[model samples]
Target chain A: MKVNEVPQDGNNFKGSDKVKKLVYAVDKDGKYTGVNTKGWEAESFATQQAWAAVEEDLKETEQQVKEGVLSPIAYFMQKCLMDLPLLAKHVGKWQWQVKRHMKPLVFNGLPAKTLQKYADAFEVSVEELKSFGK
Target chain B: MNSTNYQHCQHAHCESGVTSNLLKYAGMDISEPLAFGIGAGIFFGHLPFVKVSGTPGTTFRTWPGTIFKQVTKTLGVKVHTQSFKSVDKAMQALDDVLATGKPVGMLSSVYYLPYLPDAFRFHFNSHNLIAYGKQNGEYLISDPVMEEVSTIKPEDLIKARFAKGFPEPKGFMYYVNEVPPTVDFEYAIKKGIKKTCFMILSPPIPWFGNNAIFLLAKKVKDYPKKLTPRKAALYLGNIIRMQEEIGTGGAGFRFLYAAFLQEAADILQKQELREFAEELTQIGDNWRNFAYSAARLMKDRKSDLVSFDELSDMLYNIGTEEKQFFERLKQVKW
Candidate 1:
């Protein structure tokens, strides 16, 4: 793409006013030049769609949490964009142990230290995590 | 050891920019595109079995750290590299290096970096940046995708470096120790181009290289038949995001590579490579056209399997033409 033609239809770069990504385009002289673009239409759509999918999952997880079918750990895990394997690894527990913690009954009987581990992994407070879907 | 001499150039890709910036600081003049090309960073992979964010994995470049390793090795630059199992030790090591006034490049996760806008943050674990020094407890950052130097708090930096996932950073860090004053660009460029050609054309499986493009095309062709419309659109949108949104410098590094060929042509004075550069630019445009068409289909979501047929056809042509492009590049006389 030419420099002038480089699409600047900008997405506000995910709502940040400050950062602009660099794009390599040709100038009028047909020489390659580095130009900063706020964003482009195609990119913005893709990002939105991905985030939308995540949001949808979040909603479903929220519904499950409300029904007590899953524990708050599941909600926070999805909120953090982490899968069970990742959250388990981060918390230094086996996947099955982490999966067990996602059960509301199992999560409720967990000790404070256990809750703290999951909260720390998600970068949230224990209280905030426990308060999910309330 | 002081980083006062360091010049930060925001680049299309993080590792390539970090590679270029580090080389420039070492007193060698290397642009981002040149570093990317010399590092053989451009690539194509669409793995059906591997899932990223619930969509099939699609990568437009070589694995992370390959560019830095290959480019430095090829140029005989000495580097200090290490990975840490202990987070405290890692942060301490970073501080110790910064204390000596040397800048260090390291892997990070975009999700933990708050300096970036919310729109761009994700759980991507292989983002790269440079830590020049510590100031009032915040680490100075020279992220390649950002326009200028920024700072990150120690806690956030720690989280970024330690983000748990595939390709985990594990607090991996490196810095250039020495760079030769005089180097051979002609040889490096030729090697870079050759490596790229081999990477694209020599992979034996359909999950990688040019063959992967056709593999994904086949998948796209079946998306409407096999998956929900939303799912199909998500799969295609993920492709665009990987190709255009995630900073391949446009057209999944096609434009960046073209820029490198143009620069290489100037250095080697190869009129033939210049012609190849122009041709690749057109090819890059075709890739953009593919993205535009795909995005339109994704937006409408009303089109039938026939539209899917056309989209897959466009991608099939891209794969075929790209295969031919590399083959011809492999035959370049110099």
Candidate 2:
């Protein structure tokens, strides 16, 4: 793309206005040169779509928790942008064990030690983990 | 940490920019394109089995940390690299390195980097940044993607460095200790091009290299038939995000490599490389076009939006063009 043709169709970029990408565009002399771009509409839409999917997933999980079909651990895990396997790795628990913890009966009956580990992995305090959805 | 003694260079990609700026700090004048090309940074892979951020993984460059290692080695620059199991020790090591007036390059997760705009922060763990000094308890950062130097808190730095995910950063850090006075541009550039060709052309699996592009094209063509529109759009969006978002120097590092070729042509006086540069730039433009259409298709669900087959055909063409492009690039005479 030419320097003059570089895409400046800025989107709703959060940090993009302050820091633009140094894109390589052909200069007026038909030579490659670095040109900063605030944002590109195509890329920005792609990003928004990804985040929207995440939020939608989180909302579904939030509903499941409210319905008492799932535990707070399940909600918190998605909230942290983690699935069972990733959260399992962080808390040093087996995949099956983490899956088991997604049950309200299992999660609520857990000891302080296990809850602490889950809280630590989620970057939240034990009290916060306990009081989730309250 | 002496921030004044160092000059940070802004570039199209993060790792190459960091590599060039770090080399510059060591008194070795290297442009971002030169470092990127010499490091053989340009690459393409689409692995549907492998998932990054819950989407099928697609990479436009060599894995993180490879560019720095490859560029430094080709230039015969001595460097020290280390990864830590301890967070405190990692933070201390950074401060100690900065105290010696040397900037430290470390891998960090974008999600924990508060200095970046909210839109850009993700769970990506391979983002590179330089810590030149500490002031008032914040580590001064020279993130290559940023317009200006930024700073980070030690706590946030720890969170970023230790973010749990696939291919964790593990507090990885490296810095240049010495740079050779002279470099053979001919050998380095040829070696880089040869390796790039070999990597893109020689991958045995269908999920990688030129074959992966075809595979991705087939998948794109199938997305609507085999999945819900929402899920299909999500998959397509991930592909676009990989191609355009997070800076592969636009069009999945094609333009960056074209820029490299232009520079290489000037350095080695190879007129053929200039032509190749133009070809690759147009190919890069094609990829951008694919992204543009794909994003629109994703944003709108109507039949009037670009069809899945049209998008697939675009990718298939890109794959064919790149296959031939690299085949000729592989045969470039020194």
Chain A structural similarity (TM-score) per candidate?
0.94, 0.92
Candidate that scores best on lDDT: 1
Provide fnat values for all models in the order shown: 0.74, 0.77
Candidate 2's residue-wise lDDT over B274-321, tens digit each?
A: 999999999999999999999889878876768999999999999999
Residue-by-residue lDDT tens digits, candidate 2, A42-114: 8888888888888998899888888888888988898878877778888999999999999888988999999
List model 1 lDDT by residue over B147-250, tens digit each: 98999999999999988899899999999999987899889899999999999999999998999999988999999899998999899889998998887889
User: Model 2's CAPRI class?
Assistant: medium
Q: Model 1 segments beyond 4 Å from truth?
A: B304-306
Error of 2 at B155 (Å): 0.9
Clashing pairs for predicted structure model 2, backbone only: A15-B117
lDDT of 2 at B8: 72
